[model samples]
Target: MAVTATLTSTERQIGIAISAGLAILGLAMAAVAKTGPMALHGGMALVLGIALVFYLGGALYDHPEPTNRRHAEYYDAPTRFGIVMTLIWAVAGMGVGVWLAALMYWPEATPAVPWTSYGRLRPVHTSGVIFGFGGNALIATSFYVLQRTSRTRLADAVSPWFVLIGFNLFCLWAATGYVMGQTQSKEYAEPEWYADLWLVLVWVTYFVVYIRTLARRAEPHIYVANWYYMAFILVVAMLHIVNNLALPVTWGAGESFTIWSGVQDAMIQWWYGHNAVAFFLTAGFLGMLYYFLPVRAQRPIWSYRLSILSFWGIVFFYMWAGSHHLHYTALPYWVQTLGMTFSVMLLVPSWASAGNAIATLNGAWDKVRDDATLRFMFVAAVFYGLSTFEGSFLAIRPINSLSHFTDWTVGHVHSGTLGWVAMIVFGAIYSLVPKLWGRDDMAWPKAVEWHFWLAIAGTLIYVVSLWNAGITQGLMWRAYDEGGALSYSFIESVEAMLPYYAARTLGGGLFLAGAFLCTVNCRATMRAAGDRVDEADRPLATQPAE
Candidate 1:
């Protein structure tokens, strides 16, 4: 359905005006940049804005004005659109990731072009998956959770679109800019000054929409899911603005330099990087798990106090844990110790959240056994527990010595991302897709079962291969002969990785296939649109107001 079909004439006009303003902004940027990635990006934005303006404008006169009853129903068109974008990014991002994984052992496959080089495409895979795929899931689910928990509709029709569409534009800019060699060279925060500024606008609007909706909520007590979602938004904004504190060489150019230097720069980067893991990857999805897992199992959260405890624990402990990444470096020893200590402390809350999720399924084992959707969630909780424990262990100074700079670190990250984050997302997508489209179940229920197994096998293969590869690299690098000389050449370690690299590539391919299957399943489900709309699916508010 067209977004404008649900909007009142006033809302449609607002959308058109916003679209026009965006077109003007893009045109201005294109005119100023004239040539280069910035110009091309501006042109893309111009096309997008023009298309939206035409879409909204075309519907403005053609569609009947929406009634006050819209205020009674939950705003869902934006959620539907966000889900579509989420799948698109899942394919694009994971496809690039599988390609990068293959390129590791098959270096000859990399194209001679600058953009296809490992350096450029690496961030494309990272940002594309993290921001594009993961971020969209968070936003879409947050909108859905916010309305249901609050018992109110979104504050306005327009802001949700602005947030989702604007955020996707930022993702597009990040990926395309990386391909065009426009980056600040910061990990995770790669997009340069203009994109950073654009995100600030988008993020603030998201926060405002969230707050406004809560203000109109009929529920007296805020849900725990919102707590995590709120943390995700607020902390990410703080992290983004701080880590991306850079001065651009020129207003129109997509080049810039960060403000921090030396050890301070390293400290700042990881502070943002690790916390991006904590808040962006962990917290937002905990919110997802909190909502979707229990709902799928038909259970209340096992422990409310435990939920609050874990939230505060994560919030307090994670901030100090980033320095562990800098252990044995030029960073102060005490700082590294502090980070390690906090990381260890983090396990209590991390496990609390994970355990809380699992415990919620106290009587739902049968459901988990029979339903692929619930199984996706149950497995996610297990991985979440295991990965967080491994993280704490790896943060220890002695352990970091062995694991640091190894593929073990890579394995750990994917364990959390693929095993925990992606699992929960797929679970949520499975659970949400059928409901959102008024379906009793997925169009291909068996496809979901296939996806679950593929994902599990893929994660195990990818993570376990990397684990062996990292340990081998670490052991070989530190090995000594009887003469106290290095026993193995670095090339030998590189050669040893060939088999593991191939294994991981295959693993990643399997995961990608499952994700692709999921996308297809969702497409089919949406198209089917089974006739089973829940009459109760709406705002509880009786009067019409934003």
Candidate 2:
């Protein structure tokens, strides 16, 4: 084993023991749980808490033992988890989204099934995409980015594993909870009190690990990537806690109720709901795009100043835009106006980053053409620009009047999710796999190009169909006679949407096909990777500053 700056065997053993202990407690609690999920959750907390204690025990006592030898320890494990999970969660999350898409056009698609109903499955789809798929992408890339940018391995051995395993466990509970009809009923803040507590435990440790790693950085300036990542970590922790404010039914196990009531609750919920996208999805992914896109393609960023301008601008503007969802409802006019204004203004900052990314490909046109990874990043920038513009357009009062509560909103989201976020994640995984797996290149480069085409074609079909469907549905609903009476019945509006609905289904089906391709591509790659690695084959990740 190579000597880390602070590696020690005793510390590792203690950490491992603690993790094992907590895991045992969680299993026991889950196995013996009562009715609701809360009992099972406290049991989970016990496990997480003990694991944390053990991990920290190692980090604190496992100092490098005053050894005189200095050596490099390649970070193969971190990247492996990161890359593998990006693909795994992508398939799972996107699968949920496509299923939800089918449910939209077919009311009986759920067939009164409690677990599969729209109300329940909505959270499943949202969390799967946001937390499961997006969350995995964030953790995987953040680990890779922080290590490279800080010029250090993660702060400790057990801690990184704890972060990954603990986070995935949280995701599993979230998806399962949504299906089992357990939710706080707060939009984007649906996970119940226990899930909230679980996230708190996970997020706090994530922030600590981040800080500890940064504290021991070997670089002159903390890379902008790390700054974006840290901001995301800090803000999301605060946002998640504030929004998940529910009074639990009991310490044992049961339902919970929100402290906020009526309009006050509405305001608070949307504030948390929308910002989840801003900080959790946008900020973290932007960090990935900033570091991985350029680094993978062997190009420098277009403009550092532009990046800072956009990053700060997004941070300030996006916090208030969530209320736009509440337009023309219980929210005050000024609140709606402020929400709409900020969302519209969000366009500038969003475009700035998009522009900066696209410009970075200045001399790398050949790479963009030949490299599947670069293609993923390049198209991601394009979609980022498209999604931002569409978002701003949808937030406008005239457009919201038509598209609010329609399939248009869904279409707009997928533009961001499938087009922008998923594409970038695909690029990151392609770049990270070889780096992590200790191979010279992808197990099959051509398959990645195939994955890219499948995703793009599917996305175009999906987004375009919904755009058409949303406008048609919106106009049909508001059709009026000269006497200001309804010209079209609600069912008529539904009827007009049939062809579009079928098209949307087709488009979503195509997206799923591409995702399935990715799953196969990733599985084959993993199988090729045996149990152990040859350290000499590691990629050039940490290099001297240019």
List the RMSD of every prediction in angstroms: 1.0, 4.6
1-546 in candidate 1: lDDT tens per residue? 566788888989999999999898889889988898888888888999999998988888878888877888898888899999999999999999999999999999998999999999999999999999999999999999999999999988899999999999999999999998988988999998888999999999999999989888999999999999999999999999999999888877788889999999999999999999999999999999999998889999999899999999999999999999999999999999999999999999999999999999998899999999999999999999999999999999999999999999999999999999999999999988999898889999999999999999999999999999999999999999999999999999999999999999999999999999999999999999976879978788645655
Which parts of model 2 are misplaced by more than 4 Å? 1-8, 24-33, 39-71, 109-113, 530-546
CA lDDT of 314 in candidate 2?
A: 94
Best by TM-score: 1
TM-score versus the correct structure, for each prediction: 0.99, 0.89
lDDT of 1 at 404: 97
Cα lDDT, model 2, residue 333: 91
349-440 in candidate 2: lDDT tens per residue? 99999999999999999989988888999999999999999999898888899999888998998899889988988888877676565555
Best by lDDT: 1
